[model samples]
Target: MRTLRDDNILKLPDGRQLGYGEYGDPNGKPFILFHGNPNSRLLWGVIPGSPFLPGTRLIAPDRPGFGLTDFKEGVTTLENWHNDVIALADSLGIKKFAVFGPSGGGPFALACAWKIPERLTSVGVFASVGPFLPETVVNASPTVRTLWKYAPRLPGLFRVQMRFFAWLARYFPNLYVRMILTEFSETDRKDYARLKVADFLRPDRSEGFRQRGICTWYDAMIPATWPIPLKEIKIKVFLWQGKEDISVPFAMGRYIAEQIPDFEATFINGFGHFWIFEHKHMGEMLEVLVPPSSSPRSK
Candidate 1:
């Protein structure tokens, strides 16, 4: 497994401090990773070694207001998010890199493909957010489906809802974990049992609400906004979705694959939302993102 590095904060030209962390070989090929909603860079535990690719550096950045970064609140749009990413890359002296977004981060990855395709070597979106058409929203879990249907029109309600969960996560972490685990598929529950998932959830849950309540609320409201121009994306794209995923749902991934002009979609049979981050699943994604020079790893 790659050695975990401490968090590093970059002072952007705009004076915003962006928190990020690096994993794997520092000198290896760069791949910028965007975490899911209400999640920070800390969620990506560690990357195990793989044979198909030589080496890679995974860069995980906490979106504005999620971790140590300051929340931009009303100032954050898809364009603004893309600009922040570019600034971070420039500061790192990295001109080109791959972009990966697991869930809520998916839209941001697509935004990069749309706004700065020249700078990206490839784009990978796993269980990505899709267009908020009525049919798509219907496939989501009950709680998420309700939020997706009404959150845009009632942003205050969304804030209240997240704040409640935040309070639960802070004051009663064990209970909060139990509540959340109920939403996961059986496969994910087994994975959670074997790992310290609660530890990863605690910090983001507390800080995300305390520091950037509006940012969290607004990010959830993204699907209600204008549709991303996925068809315009020219960079190579990889889309992965699990058939049993309820948080984002399989339909969401299918929709994204249909919209992207250049994409390879992989649908796993029994996995759910959290399984994509597991070592086995992540290895598969890395193979696609960083194919071998002689012959690419087959899906």
Candidate 2:
């Protein structure tokens, strides 16, 4: 089992570095895990026991500006991410793979599905926001809604907020975890303590802040005017959301699901965003992405 300290770097054609963490069976069915905002590839550490499902090779990558990945300068939209994902897959000699996005990573996952559906075997998103319109922003958690309210109009103030978040994640890791936990529902909070999620999240959160909060801010802000045409996505998309999720409103998930041409969803009553990564829950997600008949046991 490799820890988050292990670094894997791949230099892309654009002269930027893409940093990723490879977990589970190296030769197993390839599955890319797109992490959320303010989290690095090390977010994989949050899964108790192994991060990947049986017979699934989990490739968790830091999107530009998070963790070891180089931050892109100026205005870059979510559409640009499929190129990186394709490049990474080609480098790994993977012809086809599944993609799972959690939280903010949802847009990137959808982007891949839209732009490179031929290369994708499966796609899914858990507790993620979609097409961050004014109505969508209204569905966000109070904290996130407040940030969305100000992030565009008050760019300087947003940067200051991001800097403060960086400081909190770096200097007060425990508190940082707790602060995030505060938004979780009571159901999720209990699982947080039982699973010791903060233990795994502390380092991941700290690494996410290594580049400070500007990248995270940009990442969070991109969906406001999503470039991907969800109606044109040719691949099937699976969605999971918790009605009790306060971090990302359940309606956001519903919005995306409705737009997707081929979509299936499972909305749980009591679950929350953070709790979806619980080992068993993640396993179930993988089961849907890659059914038992097609999946072989991990060597």
Candidate 3:
């Protein structure tokens, strides 16, 4: 695992520095990974083992205000993120690549699909979030649903809440892990224990909140409107949704599937948001974009 960290910051044309992490084969196919809310690029390093395809290079970037990236207020929007992504890829001399968006990062993936489909080969979303509508909010888990519904209206309060959560994750990791497990399904809880994800989450989240919680508030509120035109996306999208997922409800995934012009969906029966990534689901998701010869086999 190799992270670009602060030393390898990619200086964008706009004078903003973007922090990123790189994993898997350095000289292989490129894939940009968009992490979920309250998370930084460090989330990719936390996966128990290297689940990325053998011939694949995974690059995860910290959105503005997260990790080592400098925050730009009033400049952060779904559409605006595409420009940053394009700049990142251009700087790497990568003309085209695949994109994978997980949880809160899903909308950004869609944003790329919509804004820069010509620069992408494929798009995949894992337990991805959807437009925050009344129906979607009502179906989501308690903690996330509340944040989604009220974050935009009460940005300051939600920022404080996210700050508290980040503090808990940093200082009291065990309690933070337990609190997160409460919303997952029974199967997910068992997998979380088996993987002992608690160990990695502390550092992953610590980096995510390196700039504190303001980015989280914006991440939570941005999905409410989905300013991008999903219907205009021409790239084929592959997605996996766990029926038991409450953190991002099944309905949200369904809504996304319905809106995409070309989408392939695998709706799992018993899985939830977190466990799916820890197991076979990730390998299966990767196979959708990469060639079979370079695909990874799940442990």
Task: Give lDDT tens digits, candidate 3, residues 44-86.
Answer: 7777565666667788898777888887887777879999999
Rank list by lDDT: 2, 3, 1
TM-score of each: 0.88, 0.91, 0.91
Identify the runs in model 2 with alpha carbons over 4 angstroms from their true place. 1-6, 134-139, 295-299
* Candidate 1 TM-score, C-alpha based: 0.88
Off by over 4 Å in 1: 1-4, 46-54, 194-196, 199-212, 292-299
Give the clashing pairs for model 2: none
Cα lDDT, model 1, residue 295: 24
Clash counts per candidate, in order, are 0, 0, 0
Query: What are the per-residue Cα lDDT tens digits for candidate 1 across 1-299?
Result: 46457478898777788888776777777888898877777666433223213467777888876777776656667767888998888877888888889888899899999989998878898999777777675567876766676788998888887778767767887997898776666777876776555665566566545553555676778777745787888887898888888778788788878888888998988877877656566767877876655221111
Q: Candidate 3: deviation at residue 52, Å?
A: 1.5
Give stretches of model 3 more than 4 Å off: 1-7, 292-299
Residue 126: error of model 1 in Å?
Answer: 0.8
